[model samples]
Target: MQAASFTGILKAIFYMIAFYYIFRFLAKLFLPLLVKKVVEKAGQKFQQQQQHSQENPWNKTTAKDEVIYNTANTKNPRETKKVGEYVDYEEID
Candidate 1:
């Protein structure tokens, strides 16, 4: 009876460890899907802002999403912001 209980407990522990790794693998796989959703939402927001600006021609607000991104590799800090037809300066103290 004791041997049977020990075997059952060992099986249960093995199953628990397997389940934990499976969960981690699934989460890693779905991470890109989550990122894609976020990027799509950002694009929609940018489009709405563009349409609103078109309706109000007098508004001089710049489009934040006009920037293009290369998902390959980009590490330059300045590359994050779009270099539009205007100047943006930050004071360095």
Candidate 2:
């Protein structure tokens, strides 16, 4: 079995530090551009939703609609008519 030497350990540490700095530089260079693109996409989506709502009125119903019911205003009482005949049932065991 080959044991790792001090030089190999130092090289690994250096490579890790180099990779960390490289990733940090890349994030600094591209993070703002990515964020800007995301914000622009969100704005465009919101505008499209607004325009769609404006175009179609069916999507604009709020929670405050008032329901009105009109009843009959007759002076006399409503005459009730008989509807059905009652049936007698017998059970056998």
* Best model number under lDDT: 2
lDDT of 1 by residue, 14-70 (tens): 999999999999999998999999999999999999999888887465775375789
Among these predictions, the greatest TM-score belongs to: 2
RMSD of each: 19.8, 13.0
Reference-based TM-score, model 1? 0.46
Residues 13-68, model 2: lDDT tens digits: 99999999999999999999999999999999999999988898794678888887
Off by over 4 Å in 1: 1-4, 57-93
What is the TM-score of each predicted model, taking all chains together? 0.46, 0.63
Candidate 2, residue 74: lDDT = 57
Native-to-model Cα distance after best TM-score fit, residue 24 in candidate 2, in Å: 0.6
| CA lDDT, candidate 1, residue 53 | 82
Q: Which window of 10 residues has the lowest lDDT sum in candidate 1?
A: 72-81
